[model samples]
Target: MFKPAEGPVRLPSGQRYLGLDLGSKTIGLALSDTGHRIASPYQTLARKKFSADAAELQRIVAKEGVAALVLGLPVNMDGTEGPRCQATRAFARNISQLMPLPIALWDERMSTMAVQRMMTDEADLSRARRAELVDKLAASYILQSYLDWVGGQPT
Candidate 1:
């Protein structure tokens, strides 16, 4: 079965979905169960060489039974691709070689800021605490956005 970058993707129908919020220093993780109703934050991985990162990601995919991957695309404010977007695509291409899962790139313009704001207002967390959790929380945000869109919520 084939999966598109957006919309309803047809997979094997029994595997979980994985979401990745890739950053300069860390990669946030989120997982969706086979039913794809809810998405939960998983973990954050410190950035490293591509080989090492791919290995770690492979481990997560294996352990979580991930059928497809959702990658957050850091597009510019004007909705144009920039250097960061290029980097993300490069990373996606490289990872697709190691694991052939369908990859979807979701817009991630304000995901980090939204996560930080949520941490600050809802949790009343200190700056340091927010920084520590921002990546993984952003992953949750990304996954939630994708899920909402897939559920036919307005964009």
Candidate 2:
């Protein structure tokens, strides 16, 4: 019953959204407040078998009362999709079969880089510390961006 979301995601009151940043070795997770105004870093899941990953996600969705998902879609600076985009889409398709929720693909160009820069320049975190936090923080940024966009949409 899961399908790609085409526009602003409308959620029921008291429900939340989950944001994801999929990497080769890990998947970063973020959660939105029930009001859908703020996104906070949740946790990072190490990449494993697809079934295991999806199961973990399902558990989070149920526990968090998540109503939908906002998954980062990495695109080139020139706005062209490449292998990474394809992989993300494939993951979405696979996960949808298991979880019935709307999935919005948000352009994630430079999201990681932006997070890295903020951690290094503003936070002044060591490389090890940044490495530990960047993925989840990037997920937060992606989710915040989506929420902001949704807020601006016509009611």
Candidate 3:
């Protein structure tokens, strides 16, 4: 049986990390700098079977030299885990078994909402465009929050 990978090795110079926002229909992706200071939306992956998704993620990990993965944990406003959060955890567990990468779950409450608002208010994007881009933007938001928290900054 395959065991899950251990936690990430702390680097002298923090290595680049990947962030994921796992949705029912799509998966949002983000990448952080080696310095772990900034995170940017990388792309959105249309949801597919677990095996295929894992293969694609493995490719990204190999190509990007990713040191760890930050998974967004969806939570209710009351700070409780919900069905979505459980789903995200299951995804992470399975991915860890395959890739053995260090993974941490970050709170993602309001991330999607914040991204939608940003698209509407700043970009003035229409609903359709916002819908198309919100997942990746939410991934970015989740990653940025994690980075901030890990670096001892307020999220």
Candidate 4:
């Protein structure tokens, strides 16, 4: 189902969408319901390689009936794009070639830092536990933000 996209994905109702926090060594995953109202942490995929990661994600997308992707774009704080942003865009391009679904890049500035702060200050989690939860939690944060924006937009 790897369809090429012209731009960012426009999410439709009654279809699940997967959110991703793509790290160099791991990929965090979150899933929105058919209604696209609630998003929850789905999994943290350990990166072995691009093809393998995409294949696993493809399987999950098919299994979950996911209609699109919401990828966290790591933008810089000064409202400027940097190497990480460029790398993410390239990753999106490569992934777009592999999957037909639209990949929306959500501004993910401080998503990880926010997640870490929440885990440490609010959850009172240990460093090891925080390490385990941060990625997926960050993915959830990204998805939730996107869902809120989508809900706010006029139909």
Candidate 5:
């Protein structure tokens, strides 16, 4: 399921790519449009045990007809891998074992910070609102970047 995407990925109609921004306490989810052109914030799942989390993700994948997963990889700003990155890699490996889908590990440096700044500077949301919105929004940002990257690839 964790096959390398050497070529452009094609999915069946009505299927989508699911983006995940994994946090210690919660996992934010974004769902790509069926056309694979846009991603939108879907929901936030509070983290439990790994098995429980995987079960919930599997449920969502089935419900949304997810074709693949784009998991945010929290690499350091210096382009170095760290414990967070290791944790993400492990999560991806575990999730892939649970589901049959190609997984893309997208660099997510500062994704949460970027979303925080947007909420503060542009949206002018209150602190509580920003806290409530940051996770899912970050997932969207990660997915959008992945989609843009794929778009830039030559057909």
Candidate 6:
């Protein structure tokens, strides 16, 4: 029964946040700085059984001192919730049962495409290399978007 968080994300002092971009086959991860002002690409996790994936995430949360989770919500361009959006919500709900961290869903339309374009236009990375890096980079983009939004809020 987990719901996407409303308003600004608040956490205990000294704790960071974890950003997740969940794909059908892989999960991209990003980590925020202790001050929650910056997000960096972390790692990618291959999809596995729900229990195994949750266990790994729990372990990472403990190790990384993560206080909250920002999950990319793949809404359609028309602002409609598609199957992918439903799946992401389901994952959030299920993960909430396993871990008590607050979860926020950020609209992720065009996130991966934007990252791919950046890699091609600026980084000039090869297709194969971009494939290897896109997911994690996209996760960073998503997390950075959230951080920027928070930063713009009136304190």
TM-score ranking from best candidate downward: 2, 6, 5, 4, 1, 3
Model 2 agreement with the true structure over 1-155: per-residue lDDT tens digits: 44578899978779999999999999999999999999999999999999999999999999999989999999999999999999999999999888888999999999999999999899999999999998899999999999999999998
What is the per-residue lDDT of model 3 for residues 56-147, given as tens digits with 9 covering 90 to 100? 99999888879888888889999988899889888987888888777888879899999988899999998888888888889989988887
lDDT of each: 0.85, 0.94, 0.84, 0.87, 0.88, 0.93
What is the lDDT ranking, best to worst? 2, 6, 5, 4, 1, 3
Residue 59 error, candidate 4, Å: 0.6
Lowest-sum lDDT 10-residue window in model 5: 1-10
Give me the displacement of residue 147 in model 1, in angstroms: 1.2
Candidate number of the best lDDT:
2
lDDT for model 3, on a 0 to 1 scale?
0.84
Per-residue lDDT for 40-70 in model 6, tens only?
A: 9999999999999999999999999999999
Candidate 6 weakest ten by summed lDDT: 4-13
Candidate 2 regions off by >4 Å?
1-3
Clashing residue pairs for model 4: 1-100, 2-99, 2-100, 3-100
* lDDT tens digits, residue span 21-110, model 4: 999889999999888889999999999878998899999999999989998989989889998888778878888888777788889998
Tell me the lDDT of model 2 at 142: 99
Model 5 lDDT per residue over 74-105, tens place: 99999999998889988987887888798888
Q: By the lDDT metric, which is better: model 2 or model 6?
A: 2
| RMSD after CA superposition, every candidate | 3.0, 1.1, 3.2, 2.5, 1.6, 0.9
Prediction-by-prediction clash tally? 0, 0, 0, 4, 0, 0
Question: What TM-score does structure 4 among the candidates reach?
Answer: 0.92
For candidate 1, list the clashing residue pairs, or say none.
Answer: none
All candidates' TM-scores? 0.91, 0.97, 0.89, 0.92, 0.93, 0.97
